[model samples]
Target: MNEHILLVNPWIYDFTAYDLWMKPLGLLYLASHLKNSGYKVTLLDCMDRHYPFMPLPDHPGPKRLKSVGCGSYYREKIPKPAQFLSIPRYWSRFGIPWDEVKKQLKEIEPPGWVFITGTMTYWYPGQVAFLNLVRQLWGKTQVIIGGWYPTLCSEHAHQWGFDRIIEGIDPLLVIKQLSSDFKELSTITGYKEFFSVKPAFDLYKKLDYTVVLTSIGCPFRCTYCASGRYFSEFWRRPWEQVLDEITYDYENYRIQDLAFYDDALLYRAEESFLPLLKALQKERLPLRFHLPNSIHARYVTREIAELMRECNFETLRISLEFSDVDSQKNTGNKVDNFIFEKAIQSFIQAGYAPEELEVYLLFGLPGLKAKDYELSIEYVTDLGLKPRLSLFSPLPGTPDFEKVIMHQIKDDPLFQNKIAYLYLSEQNELYEALQRKISKYTFFH
Candidate 1:
């Protein structure tokens, strides 16, 4: 029997969305597992900006490509959800058209099961739309939904029309569940073969860039972050396996850019990162790495910084979540001013330009004042480092979520959108002022 499974990366229905070399990595990993289990797998990326089937008018052209693999998405302004009607900005469905999605589904043979991956809780509208479409086409086919959204808001995910919902980040948990349900478990000869299975990146039509997760979960328990909640365990993968994955993509696909999705890239660097960097340097590949997730400032030792420079670390971001002592203590004390200073100095001494080293300053906390953000920006600018503001989104299962009033959320996941929901007057004023101030000091290096 030909047991085929359809994997879907749903669209982003929001006020704004961007492709920071984003991919449904979990779904791709699942695809590889299914393929190994003797089931045919197909991926339908609804948010594929490069999909040629649905082309936009040449008059406007597609949103201009920015940087090597990061750029804007094809956005179509849609009516805002009833709850977000008061918000001024236009709501958009950021992805290919609905007709194109249906067309792609029709091209493939009907599968026995449709596996859909969910991202942010606020983006549930996209998942709902995807599930509705899947039902229309394959009435009796099983629909299994999983990922961050279902894991964080399992109760809420039930309303999305999924036949079954799986939570947590364990790939083995998923495999075991499927095997028990289907009664056709693939024979696992040994642990070596299991860990050797790579993500099915070949499923994509064209690969612009890929994401890597060398380490799972995070060591620090930040109040605002749900990293610990999602994984609940901190573990690093084998460096040899990581190296093989990177080289495979580089040699086979000619991929130049790789985005690291690790929550703690620099945690215990001597054990994981140090060896990985040394190996990459030995290979002398012309590939550039991007750390989209900020690293621990304290972990940025002089030696690590020097090694990163040698390996062509194109984008380096360190987390300086807050400046004040109270705020720093409240949210995990990942980096203090003293530690941050040393890390910045190390990068600069290692020949990294100011623009190349961006420090992330968090904003939009419940009790945080605008002055806190202003002082932090001033400190980062004074030290000649670029400031990248990461607005806070109150995710369920985070420490900060308990501090706020859940009644205000009203069970609407849309309230989880930081841009649309966290619109405090003071934060808004500070954000705008900082944007204007930083615009004058813009330098590319």
Candidate 2:
């Protein structure tokens, strides 16, 4: 008999979060593999808005969905976590309520094994809550947790009582380990190659959007980023496979929003992105696409911009690490002012408005000056693009990790605060002052 496996996509607990076409691509891929291996796969998405037990809002209407398949979640105010009580923001659970999750688990009658996915280190509370509920219901069942948070903080996850925590993108070794212990589990074959399996979007009651990864890993090794360490190799799916997945999501699931989760979507445009875009254009499906992950500036040529415009890319973000040339090289000379300017011009010529173009500015980094980011914000705004400030969080393995150690900032008690602004060590106080000065342009406003 095929053993049953349950995949759980847990709720997001945060001060604020939006569905920017985000989906657990890793977990979904695992689910597809398990199904192909003859396991009865059941997915419990706690983020489902159409969950039967969800409370009816005071207002009556189909939920307000933005054109790009990006919008709000069903949120309910919850008490702040004990450690985060000092923060003034009202923390809420962003998904179907806890009662609904419990109801769904009971209805599913549990499974042979439970797998949970997580992202962002601070978002661990949601994963922990889901795991606790799972433990209460099926004490004997094995629980495995993986994803960004676990990959970054495995020790913390082990301390939380997760039966096993797998780090890194490859799951073959972990599967082998599990099989050794379970003895009766089916073997997963041909795991080394990048497998093409449609995400289990059908498992959700209502699919608002789906995330697709046409490629994995980035070629550049930016000093502060964990991309190189996480992936270790640059691999891309064939254009046909990527397009087929897109078509499958659109035709079968009626999904209108598709987000690409690739770190380097436009690495080699002529060979990779262009062919994919042309394929999408040829299909001419009424679909809205998004690139939440930043795109390489040098790759955004006039033709590419026009292609993107034709494909109905509703939201796009380009990475502009710093305005200063010195800082640019320090970060990763991915692109310079000339490339950025040309890219913005091409995007504008292709029909994107100033407000639609977002340039991500890395706000805090060890040894960085407050004026550095302020100048970057000014530079991006002067170019008629929206400046999106991304707070810096130090990961375990990166060139910047040595910098953090040298500066002794990573050991600080408050280093984990995503908004704490610890990266400006040289001008710490000045950084806070500068942040207040730039508060007007913040996304919340």
Candidate 3:
């Protein structure tokens, strides 16, 4: 008999988290590969907003989901972790209740192995919690954990007791490692052999949106980013495969919202994104697309913007880390005034509403003054786009980690919590002053 495998996308424990077209693309890809190789795959998405067992909370209705399918997550309040006791905000687990998760696990038969995926480095507590529950229910069933958190903070993950941990996006290597260790568990399936298989979206109880990756890794190496560390090499899949995945989701699954999780989607657009967009236009499927992971501003030319609009791009976000050109160059020449202005104008001319486009402004970098972020926010707002403040989480592998350590911010465990002003010194009043300025500016409302 073929092996039964369980794949889980763990919850996010944070001060604030939204669905924002998020999905475990990597884990689902593995599930698809395993299923195609004759394994019975079961997916447990803890972040499923439409989970049927939970009672609906008294909250606002769903946000304006575009015709293509991107929307929000159902949220509930939970106690903040002990480390964040100093922070005066309610930190919640952004997913289903613990009881519901346990109940679902109880219903499943003993599997050969369980695969778990992680996200933000600071959100490892969620992964730990999920693993603990799995241990409780399955009693020594081998669990494998991988993704951004494990790949970046492998040392920390070892303490969490996962039987095996794989890093990076090399699915073939991971399968080999799993096969060698758990030969009795299942038959080995190489990545090339499973290339044609689609992700097991059918295992999901509710399909809000589907995530697709046309490429992996990024060409540029930014000091503050972990993209290079996670992917290590840039590789683009065939355009036809991308189109087929989109079409399959639209036609067969009735999935309208598709999010591209590529770190570099727009780079070399003539060869990469353009062909895919043209193919999509030719098909004229009534579907909407999103780039939740910010795209490269340097490549967003007017032609690309028009093509994106023609291909039904519903939501897009561009990374505008700093308004100061010198600061931006110091971090990485990821954006320049020329590129920024052109990208903004191209999207505007391409018929995207100002509100539909957002510019992510990184807040709380070491040595950055409160006035600097204030100016950055104002600059993005002046560009006729929403300024979304992405609080900087100091990952272990990023250049910022040494800076953070030198500053002794990590000395206090509370500093590891991303939501807190980690870069600010305990005696520094800059954080409170910046918070006041942000509140006074009031643009997102």
lDDT of each: 0.79, 0.74, 0.75
Per-residue lDDT of 185 in model 3: 22
The regions of model 2 sitting more than 4 angstroms off are 56-65, 171-194, 401-417, 420-445
| Backbone clash count, each prediction separately | 0, 0, 1
lDDT-based ranking: 1, 3, 2
Model 2: ten consecutive residues of lowest lDDT: 406-415
lDDT of 2 by residue, 201-243 (tens): 7777777788888776788889888775676467667888888
For 1-445, candidate 3 gives per-residue lDDT tens digits of 5878889888888776766777777677778766666788888888877778755544543557533454445556787766567766777777888778888888889887888887776677778888888888888688988776676666767877898888665655566666665453244454334356688787876786888887766888888887766544667777888898888888777877788888899887787689899888889998878887899989888888988999888778899888998889888799987789889899889988877887888876777777788788788777766777776767666787667643434443235556664423342255556656555555445
lDDT of 1 by residue, 301-415 (tens): 8988998999998888888977788888878888899999999999999999887887898877778776777888888888877788888888888878777664556477778
Alpha-carbon runs more than 4 Å astray in model 3: 65-78, 182-195, 405-415, 421-445
Report per-prediction Cα RMSD to one decimal.
2.7, 4.0, 3.3
Clashing pairs in 1: none
Model 2, residue 15: C-alpha shift (Å): 2.3
Predicted model with the maximum lDDT: 1
Which is the better candidate, 1 or 2, if ranked by TM-score?
1
Q: What's the TM-score of every candidate structure?
A: 0.93, 0.87, 0.89
Model 1 ranges off by over 4 Å: 56-65, 182-194, 424-427, 441-445
Select the stronger candidate by TM-score from 2 and 3. 3
